[model samples]
Target: MDATPVAPPTRAADARLDRIPVVTRSHRIWVALLGIFFTFDLVDLNTFAYVAPALRSEWGLSITAVGAVTSVSFLGMFLGGLLGGRLADRFGRRPTILGSAVFYSTFSLLSAVSVNVEMLAVTRVLTGFGLQAMTGVLLVYVTEMFPREQRGRYQSLTLALGLLGVPIAAAVSRLLVPIGPGTWRWVFVIGAGGIVGVILSVRLLPESIRWQVAQGRAEEAEPVLAKLESEARGILGRDLPEPGPAVETAESGNIRELLRPPYLQRLTVASAVMICLILGFYGFSSWIPTLLVEDGYTQTESLNYSLVLAIGAVPGALLAWPLVDRFERKTLILGISLVVTVLLLAFGISSGAVLVMVIGFLINMLMQMLVAVLYTYLPEVFPTRLRGLGAGCANSVGRLSGAAGAFIVGGVYSGLGYTAVFLYLALVILLLGTLLALFGERTTRRRLEDVGSAPEPA
Candidate 1:
């Protein structure tokens, strides 16, 4: 086994670390653990959507009432994003991950036991809080742990694997929800999938090497690096490559740093991206089955419609692997949003069962691709010191927008009908592209230490 030096690379964690190529034993393990962790997140994410129609019938709730439940869940996510990143930075990524798992697991169980919509909404809020917290930290962990050159590809790979959970949730809901009146409750039980994920995480997940060194814990990073080198050397069948040139990195900064100059503009762009994403994502994806139900489809019919649409999620995420590293991150985000905009418009005007299915599939496919790319692009904008908090704040803001979007879409659908809601969604997506195109800075192929919202101070 190759012995790791006692100290971290002089410049920062990326200096010697980037010399290791994209794949290694450690890389695969990290990706697998993150993927599994995110898998349960996705499963829980779509659970309420799948159960909404049944919820309407059993609870005798209005469509707006159901939308309000979804809205409150976004409010919960807003709190989670606010806390997830700052907590990760202050506490540690692995501990944050574990804590989030425990929270979602407990609340999801509470969600299942809801005797009234009030109880369900409250539990769903807590569940959303934990889920978003884990999500924000995980995004930070993925970018920090992986090799710099192929960060986007690996992120896509992890998400593609995670995309499996959508179909799993869809299929499970389809199977369990309609079995009887109370079977819908069983679906929330599935959200406990995090319990298994947390177990796997404890066995395999390492604290992020970059985060460790950033926290002035090089001793902690060393053993992890040594194990990685030993595994990588076996794969390479020779000595490791020479270290790359070092790039400057800042010492740790407090959460308030995200509000200061240099980072403020980037925070604005990131927040815009998050808002646009939530507006589009919550308005459409979360409302799919409910949207169909509102349009006169039966509960069973809507669930079937969503299950078919779920087919596109995996391929959409997998498709990002090739294009993510190929194009400039900012330009690529704009391009994908353009396609998603057109697709959303097409879906709104679509008619006939087959046409609706086809258009929805295309919209979801491209949307997942957009999601994978944005995750890679967003973190590249912040300094390591504040990356998690910045991302968390941005995501929290988006979740706040998402709460408004759920209400806005439901109100629009009720007032103007389905087409108007879609038009509103398309507009939000276009705004996302426009904001990023004008203000987003470039970060393609540059080392993380070298890239920033503004040039580093001399």
Candidate 2:
């Protein structure tokens, strides 16, 4: 009898998929779709910031009460991030993303119809739950799908696109919030349209091939791998290059493994960076108009300033694309964080409107740069099985800290001053930069397969 034919190794699918070059038509299309998905998340993410001042004026809320409205959403985000990550790892990235889209979209419209502060806060908390979990899953999907060499660049593109929502939210609020009483409700009404994109994403987005291979579903992974190979061949117009040697990796789908060796350090570092960044980001960025209003700027002037500040965020994100592959992500994050610290300090001391706007613009720009870099950096540290869980857990820390920071800033601003709040933000940012520079591992131009599976020190 003839000898039994042997099956090709399963990891060949992974090897084949990884060898595809970046910047293909197919690749660009994928980025665009993911970018649209992220755009909605950001719109909902930032909706409250623009509307909070209006809400405060309408409800006759105290500063702490306004901050509480903001903080409640983050409280929901904390749970959402943790739960979303676990679900993505357990079920699939695509489904979690779809469900999150539906959940947030429905509740966002409900917020518009809310009759009182308490009702609006409840809707926002539910909205936050879906919004953040969707964001966590989006990062995981992007990290897995993009080419290793250009992962940072592509992720930055999505970030730039997502940051556009900030400006969009600002523009909407500037136009609508000043019209008359109850106009703030229109902000959420326009934002509810983001749900439409979800239907499109469910149809267009591909399931992650790396995820399939990691789950030991080689048979399922092969067909997806073949499609990717075909796309690469079309782009190259020739035979593909040989894939690198495959390293053996454990199929760990457990959250417990995240607390063990090879993952614990990543968890710690990502969580630290996330916590500080979110505190500084939301503590300042989301609260910009409110802070300005307290500092004596009119609502219209504050909204205009915020709109200009929001415009800077797009470039801030775009600037990272060219440098992301060239410089190590850790170094870039550190540098941007330091710039943010100085700008925050400068912003605290400045007096003139032009000066404040200029300083605020610069600060927001640098903040977005930090955002692009960290979003790219954090997801690179964990394995496919734990990528969602690890990122989710880290994101939870940031959300919770951000919630606390919002409250602290409100209390401090009400008692101490804007100067005190800026000082606190600057200090937090400085420590975050220092910690990342000292302890974070380099992930420049590294393949996801190698970066994800490589052994770490105990």
Candidate 1 segments whose C-alpha is farther than 4 A from its true place:
1-12, 244-250, 453-458
Q: lDDT tens string, model 1, 1-458? A: 45543334454455667666657877888888888878889988889988988888899989888889998999999999989988888778899998898899889988899999999999999999999999988888878777777899988988898888899889999999888898889888988788887888787888877677667765667767767766767777766776666453436768677777888888988998899999997788899999898788888888888999998999999889999988987788899889889989989988888999999998888889989988988888886678788888999999989888888988898899999888998998888888898888777676776675357334
Q: What's the TM-score of each model vs. the native?
A: 0.95, 0.95
lDDT of each: 0.84, 0.83
| lDDT of candidate model 2 versus the reference | 0.83
Clashing pairs in 1: none
For candidate 2, write residues 207-298 as lDDT tens digits: 77777777776677665566666666766767677777654353756877888877888899889889999889888888889999988999
lDDT leader: 1
Q: Candidate 1: lDDT of 267?
A: 91
Model 1 global lDDT (CA atoms, 0 to 1) = 0.84
